[model samples]
Target: MERQRMSTSEELMHLPWWMVLLEGIAALIIGVLLLTSPGMTTLVLTQVLGFYWLIVGVLALVNLFVDHSLWGWKLCSGILGILAGLVIIRHPLWSTLFIPALVVLVLAVQSLIQGGIKIFEAFRGGGFGAVILGILNILLGVVLLSAPLMAAFVLPLVVGIFALIGGVAAIFGAFRLHNSALRASIQQTPT
Candidate 1:
């Protein structure tokens, strides 16, 4: 018998359900922390962003070596991410300019990029929810970019709101993953 290849969604379903739950819980906790202490969160967020970019850059570079299909794009993205990460990490004060406006600008650009990716994924069978999230992220980025000064004042609140929404969505996703895993397990069990 020929073995059938699994779709992306099916492959994802094979992931341990507990990991999804943990991720959801972690997001909820971080969201609450950011909401409760925006001032401190801002500083931490900068460092976090730096580390995140660095890690992603490293992963992308590794992926380029592992999968040569999109090596050029991956190489460019990885180099940019690494450079940005290093610059931000080394001169966070310069990046922020001791002003929240700069931070908002950075976040806006990041959101715009992420939103575009999400939108593309949504078109590729990701689901309507992804489209909605992509639109929202793009709108947030546009709003911040359009009025960066104004965005600085409300940056914390806006971030808080988005974080909460993301947390909730993650939680819901966790449940869905759990259900899928349970069903898969049940189906696999012999009578």
Candidate 2:
């Protein structure tokens, strides 16, 4: 019997190599720039964050129209994104100073929720990685709360590293998205 072909969405999981390399390079550049001048990074980061929020909000809103099942999540994500973006747009300088603390707070909350979800998934016998990530998040959140000053100082560097890693992963994932045959082979491989 012939193997069933993977769908485009499934293939998207395995992105192309060039895309991954590009993403990695971009992330590395951003990381290096941030590391070299952390003080200046504050203003730049605020602007970037503002734009990111707007983009994400728009994306969420777009998804709401396209996928009704995600209406609740999409609406909340969009509204939050828009609000965050607007705050930055209104007082970018003030926002720059406060963004770090807010970022930590938001991330801490996100980590808690993500960790909880991971723990639940692990209990259901799925995604051990999620559980590990969840634990890491919990630790990170505690560290951020306990040592806010230290966290504020070092958070940018850490964010740079995360961006580099995420970019690389996205690039790699993009390749997977492009390679249907490879995706099938990988999926067929026994875990």
Candidate 3:
């Protein structure tokens, strides 16, 4: 049987709007909790990350059979993620020491790369805001790299703010999906 590929928007349209709304609400709640209790949030976040990675790994592995293209890289990535997640979940105490270090290092590298891209975009006629954001990203990357341990402590606060923004975006997305579905249904109804 041939597999039918759906466009991103079409796939999204098929999704139940209530599911999106629930996801947004859940993110909002988690964001609020993280912001309110940073210390506890870090541990919780670590555990959640582990579970996320594990689930993603499993999904990716499954997808390897579904989509054979780039299967090698997908398999490797899935296995690595699964192993890392399992190790972290099985040994929370040991994970606490190394996970934070790893997280900060990854964040530092991502910030640096993003900063560079933004700076380049700014030079290519992007707004002043881009330049400012680029500078801030570079500065943050440097600071995080300098004291990664400290950066780990601050990670929860930053993550909370980002999560809040994401939650808001998801809520808006859910409404948009709902409206589109309503319109589609109305159009399909007999006059």
Using Cα atoms with residue i matched to residue i, what is each candidate's TM-score against the true structure? Answer: 0.56, 0.54, 0.68
Clashing pairs in 3: none
Local distance difference test, candidate 1? 0.81
Top candidate on TM-score is 3
lDDT (C-alpha) at residue 180 in model 1: 81
**Least accurate 10 contiguous residues by lDDT in model 2:** 1-10
Q: Candidate 1: where is the Cα deviation over 4 Å?
A: 1-8, 52-83, 97-146
Q: Candidate 1: TM-score?
A: 0.56
How well does candidate 1 score on lDDT at residue 144? 84
Task: Put down candidate 2 lDDT per residue, 51-101, tens digits, no spaces.
Answer: 899889999999999989969989999999988988897888888768787
Alpha carbon deviation, residue 106, candidate 1 (Å): 8.1
Error of 2 at 164 (Å): 5.2
lDDT of 1 by residue, 98-155 (tens): 4478788898999999899999999999999899989999998998899987778677
Candidate 2 whole-model C-alpha lDDT, 0 to 1? 0.77
